[model samples]
Target: MNPIFKNILAVIVGLFVGSVVNMAIILISSTVIPPPDGADVTTMEGLKASMHLFETKHFIFPFLAHALGTFTGAQATALIAANHKTKLALVIGAFFLLGGIVNVFTLPSHIWYNVTDLVFAYLPMAYLGGKLIKKKKS
Candidate 1:
């Protein structure tokens, strides 16, 4: 297979894997930590309406979801790409970062949570993921 094609496929795979991880965590988050009373988390409007009721504990899963998703996706990308593994991994991070930024604008949440999620989740995880691959080669 062509290197360019392989790299493209890696990105596609990374995005899919990351999305799956994120959605999976989100799907189970409610079960693991039930939402505040009357906080309907099923829809965007519901989440927005219930945002005020959320506690710090409620934010944990989302942060894990974002971080783990980016980490796994970047790792997968770095593992599969024909070349520029780290760069491809960062691309995955950039993709998730864009989504995180969009989420900030789309939903109202605590500023501290927003800052933390935006600052610490995506790029750092991706870099770690890429770095892990390097360690394995040594």
Candidate 2:
């Protein structure tokens, strides 16, 4: 198989896996935290409207969803890439970071939550994932 094709496939698979992980966590989160009463969390507008009602504890699942999803995606990319493992992982991170940025703009949240999620979630987790792959290979 061509290395380029393999790399592309790795990226696709990584993104898919990461997105699945993210959605899974988000789905489970509703069960665990249960959104505020009458929050109508099914739509972006509804969620944004309900954001003010959320407590500090409600943010934890989202952070975990983002971080763990990025980590799992980066690790998958690193393991599957033919070369430039770290670069591939970073690419995944950047993709997720862009999504996070979009999320911030689209859905208003607490300033602290926005800052923490933006700063700590994507790149750091991706780097850790790549490092884990490297360590395992070594």
Candidate 3:
């Protein structure tokens, strides 16, 4: 396989897996975690509001989702290219984790912000997952 093609595929796989994991964490965790103070914690109400915005904007989530995918895909590609080192994973995870934390704080909605947070929680875990996946396949 060409290195460029392989790299792109690696990124796609990583982004896909990351997005699914992000969604799962967001949906499931929302049920249990209390809303941040001064923010709405009600899932139904929050989702309704989100839907309204999504319906009107029509592009925010898709754009954001794909952007997240792009970033995650890049991370995965980097991880895979790094020869599956835990140290590399840790460093990559840390960068993403910090970036995620910063993003969470910037987001206005408690829920969406937290969704990003949940997505980020997997940064380190994703690296670990990569290690396991790469290990078995190789």
Candidate 4:
């Protein structure tokens, strides 16, 4: 297979895998930690309307979902990419980061949650994923 094609495929796979993981976590989050009363988490409008009712506990799963999804996606990319493994991983991170930035504009999350999620979730996890592959190769 061509390296360029493989790399493109890697990115696509990473994005799909990350999205699946993210949605999976999100789907189960409310079951694990119930939302505030009347909080409809089913739609964008519902989430936006209920944002003010959310507590710190409600933020935990979202953070985990973002971090773990990015980490897993980056790792998958690094594993499959023909070359530039770390760079590809960072690409996945950048994609997720962009989404996070979009969420910041669209959602009404708490400042602390925004800061923490933006600072710690995407790139760091992706870097760690790339590093994990590198270490394994050594």
Candidate 5:
């Protein structure tokens, strides 16, 4: 298998896996809390009511999911030719984890802002996942 192509596949796999991980985390977390008793969850106002709950419990996990996804994606990519899969995965994981930490800082103080941030965050992550997948083999 071509190294580059393997990486590409890894990224695709990462994107799918990462998206699923993220959504699962979101759904499970949201359910445990259940929308604020009677508070609207649609409007920014409603979202704010839930922000503390979300940030408190699952924010880091999302980051972890992103990081792990990235690491996995990169490893998948490197697998095409690289022998040191573990090391490369660690490197990619570190890169991704750092990115996620930075992302946390970008979050608006406003809870409603996340909805806007959400779209911005996910796809780029997929792209980044691809980048990891396509990274040069160690």
Candidate 6:
């Protein structure tokens, strides 16, 4: 198999799996911690408008979702890539980071939440994921 093709496929699968994990966490979180009463969380616009109604606790699941999703994705990429495993993992992290940045700009989250999510969620998790894979391989 072509190394380039394998790397590309790894990235695609990693991103897909990561996104699925992210959505699953969000779905499970909604069940575990229902949104504030009368808060319409069905749409981004609604959620953004209702951000003021949420407490700090409401952000925990989202942070976990982002971090875990990134970690899973990076790990998968590192595991599958034929070469430059860490670089591939970091690429996945960059992708998620871009999404996080866009979410921050589009949504009306608290400054602290935004900072924490953006700083701690994506890249760090991805790096950890890559390291975990490397350690396991060694």
TM-score of each: 0.97, 0.97, 0.44, 0.97, 0.45, 0.97
lDDT of 5 by residue, 11-31 (tens): 455445545655565556546
RMSD of each: 0.8, 0.8, 9.6, 0.8, 8.0, 0.8
- All models: lDDT? 0.94, 0.92, 0.49, 0.94, 0.48, 0.92
Q: Which of the two, 2 or 5, has more lDDT?
A: 2
Give per-residue lDDT, candidate 2, residue 56. Answer: 92
Clash pairs (backbone) in predicted model 4? none
Q: Candidate 2's error at 50, in angstroms?
A: 1.0
Candidate with the larger lDDT of 1 and 4: 1
Clashes of each: 0, 0, 0, 0, 1, 0
Report the CA-based lDDT of candidate 1 relative to the real structure: 0.94
lDDT (tens digit, per residue) of candidate 6 on 10-123: 999889989999989998998888889978999888998899999888898999999999999999999999988888999999999999999988998899999999999999
Predict model 5's lDDT versus the native.
0.48
- How would you encode candidate 1's per-residue C-alpha lDDT over 32-108 as one tens digit per residue? 99999999899999999999999999999999999999999999988888888888989999999999999999999
Off by over 4 Å in 4: none
